[model samples]
Target: MPSKRVRYPFQVLALCLSAWGLAWAGPPAEKDKAPDAASIRRGKYLATIGVCEACHTPPAVPAVPGGGDPDRERLFRMDPDWVRYLDPQRQLAGGVPFILRLSGTTHGLVVTPNLTPDVETGLGSWTEDEIVEVLRTARRKDGRVLFTFPPHSFYNHMALEDARSLARYLKSLPPIRNPIQPRTLPFEPQPMVADGPARAPQGRTRERATYLMGALVGCRECHSHHENGTLVEFAGGSPSDPFQGSFRLGPDLPLRQLEKGFAAFPYPGFAVLYGSNLTVLGHGGALERVPTERIVRAIRQGIDVREDEYGRPRPIAHVMMWQFYKDMADVDALALADYLKTLTPVANPVGVRLKLFGTDWEAAFQQTYGEPPTPEDRAAFGMP
Candidate 1:
């Protein structure tokens, strides 16, 4: 019998296709599995702790005028209820612009994006893999870099699994079609603020805490002081409580003397609250003195401390929602505490920096707010 020519059809086809600059087509790749309910729920909780709404939610229709300008308002009016009761539909459909003012000059702008799942406007087009890419690399799916969000730094310390959990959760949100315009802004560049060394530094516990406190829990907003004239302010806490007469010694107090001592003012000038000097370590700051248990309580359940508003108490100056952080993992809480202890003890007091140093409120209005707002203007802003 003649030798049979064994036909290697598959091999020959592969070779031919390779030579022709293409591979034989195979079945279409499978899509990623959708996140389960459990994952989505987990992500929702994480988002809350991160205070994602602070930068993401469109500013509420203020009871005051000028609601059109979202930037000219306190974050969620510093109202714990306002933040907690955000509209679910518009939640994460971001268009809020956060302006960082220092010494009376606009230092930078941070306008967030809509995080909803809307196909045309939000994260609906995103996959979990893209989420992972952002948390890990700070790069967009299309190859652009993300802005310097608090998450951008600490998430680098997060576990892939946790990052995945966050991604899964975000992807699972109900789609909303709110169109957020371009979020970038034109402002003076500020120096990069490093989150400092890892808060945990040892086990799976390491980095987890700092991510929550420094990035997620958001204490740095209230628990910090500016160096070389940086704006130092926090949500839900104001120093000068006009109602209670608790106006503390600060720059805008009495004579606009630019005195430092943890200064803060609500939008539209409702109240001026001061943040506690957090970097001093022992006397007032809890870092070297307070027990971890107490610190944890303060983080999860608010303390009963009070600030003065015209010499009367007004719900601790502004509403602080520690309950949102109730479910923090134990390891993460410890991590947050550890990070808190590591805040390089800055002896300086907290104060807001305005454009014209040592100028009175009237000049400040023209220099900072433009054309001194009247009592109606202030009330219209719902701050006073």
Candidate 2:
């Protein structure tokens, strides 16, 4: 019966302090050092594969058409033009503002967050392990996981080597001292379901190509935009926004305007065309139409369908695919050609509803097809 007065709270406090002290003693010994130049270069390459700049960089305006600005202070700022059209007050992005458009409609704009290593506002304090954990796990502050990293899924099907390299590269970038506000989703955060372990596909060339296309190059992300202009999945239904469709690259430009010794060309001057369905119905369709040999020739030779001044298929712009594909040893271009042929056309109509009007279609259906029983009907049955 020594000191029967409640010592429970004090005991709890002491335990908490003891735990804190242990944690503060410093992280368990591990070799955490700055990555080497080769690792950094690998990281840079992986970052390109993920097309990290696309979201991190602000939308390109007429003043800055290509959207390549590296200035951190202005990075990831919501496009002013888009803000004017959507929210006049422009409340989000300065802080965690409620995003009304995302939930109210099928399509909505999501302000991308800044990833620069700014101490006050950016990820400057994040350790390499923390960064790796974020990409690998997709966890929120409360320890809930996210379904997808909307717009661009860098972690979606991401290879471990590539993820690590990208993380290292991000850490190495010169810290841009900009404090971007956090992103706000329309709905309350839903806990993320953990997908299975990442599997690197077999076949070196196929694996590398898939990594480039899926994680790094991000062909699917660019081609797929939700009706609200967000790039959620490879659903490929994003509307024509500011940068939705500005450049076209292929064998289909007016010949006279084409540059010397080139068949395929990049048409940046054309009216902004919404991204064509990359499925079997669109450009992927064209690729399927040709033989693997022709496909290889088209990429490596850059030959336009039309002839050059020398009466040969003029070499078009150097397709980077040719260079990348050349290094691929597996399946050759035929396998890629075959794979491109397999892309299914998205059956959903494009531009059916760019903006939602908020009508309750379900209620309308019930009224027309199955009306609720009237009070008289219930009374006749002696029902309460």
Candidate 3:
């Protein structure tokens, strides 16, 4: 008390400054500030692996008329330029048409919504919390449920922090004023796929890989069992054999395939490709003989480094969505490779490992889906 009575004004001022510094350096300081560069950077990475642009971004050229699957040839073509087909200026300005079907019956065209931050046309009015909620619950603020195409069931399993990061990144984007058409569903919506498992905790590399494969990257969707286009079961030793891969029917030519069943008739040539068995359990499972480096190559470069009958690696079909996965960070891709090697290798072979090995797929594509996108079209999308 005697010492305080003798304290100078400068000492009191110094004590106040010290207390202010401690408060400013605490956790709340970081939390209260706007989304920093690191968080935005993280969000960009999450968006890349999640393939948000695949659905949300429209094509550079107008889709072939007749309102059906736009890039039907994409199912078979292994062109590395597939990524350039999307309109760059309109990135995430959703208008991509996804034809959702059930038991071969066409429900309707679901034009993806614009994800930009435009106040009038995009998610500008949506708060960060609202965007995070959509990622968690797959339902819009208006209480409308989402379709299965975006594969919300898988995305809903994303970690909370990751989802928040995604929202922040999206909100930070330069707003684009692209108004999307409402989804045109001819039939009542039906539940096509079941929800994925709960979020895997953040820690080990394998756990991160698990979430990437099962949730964010959605490896289990096409890789899982599907009789036609309809998903039969999700995972866990069911006769369906999760991650065992599925038989993918080819393009919806003349838009008739959607009206009819996906399995009503076989696609021309090797169009009826099989989703390779990603598990190591099955005897003829595709990845069983493939090395980890090859898997990483396939994921990052869209080239299946697995040896063919002639012992040469080939390009993966464009339908595999490697163009999107190609953007994944090395650490994430490596983690996925490590985790896949640890699966309970299931021996469920779906189709021939090298269906396109001997076929003239380019000529077939020209005959079926018309000449591939021209260079002018590619340039429009900002591809060299």
Best model number under lDDT: 3
Instruction: Supply candidate 2's per-residue lDDT for 238.
Output: 38
TM-score of 1: 0.57
How would you encode candidate 3's per-residue C-alpha lDDT over 11-50 as one tens digit per residue?
Answer: 0000000110111111212334676555566678777767
In order, candidate lDDTs are 0.44, 0.36, 0.52
Off by over 4 Å in 2: 1-31, 59-100, 103-110, 140-156, 191-199, 202-274, 277-338, 342-384
- Residue-wise lDDT of candidate 1 within 1-384, one digit each (tens)? 211111100000000001111121222121255335554555566666755654566434442344345542334433333444345557677655433222232233344667777889888888776776676666777776654544344456554444555676677667778765453333322223333332223322545654455444546545443333443422122222211112211222110111111122222232233345444443345347756665566566665333245654333323234545565555556666655555545444325412233424444433333245465434322224
Compose the digit string of candidate 2's lDDT tens values, residues 1-384.
111111000000000001101111123221265455555565664443333433344322212323344442132222211111111121111211111111112211233344555666556677655565566566643464443433233464555544555566676666655455444343443333323234344332555445555544534543455455354333343333322221222211211111111101222221122333545322444334645555455434445434557787664332122322233333434444444445655543555322221233222212211343344322321223
The segments of candidate 1 whose C-alpha lies over 4 angstroms from its true place after superposition are 1-31, 34-38, 59-80, 99-110, 149-154, 184-207, 226-274, 279-291, 304-323, 329-331, 338-346, 349-384
Candidates in descending lDDT order: 3, 1, 2
Candidate 3: residue 61 Cα off by (Å):
1.2
* Model 2: lDDT to the true structure: 0.36
Better of 1 and 3 by lDDT: 3
Q: What is the C-alpha RMSD of each candidate to the true structure, in Å?
A: 18.2, 18.9, 17.1
Total clashes for model 3: 6
Model 2 TM: 0.47
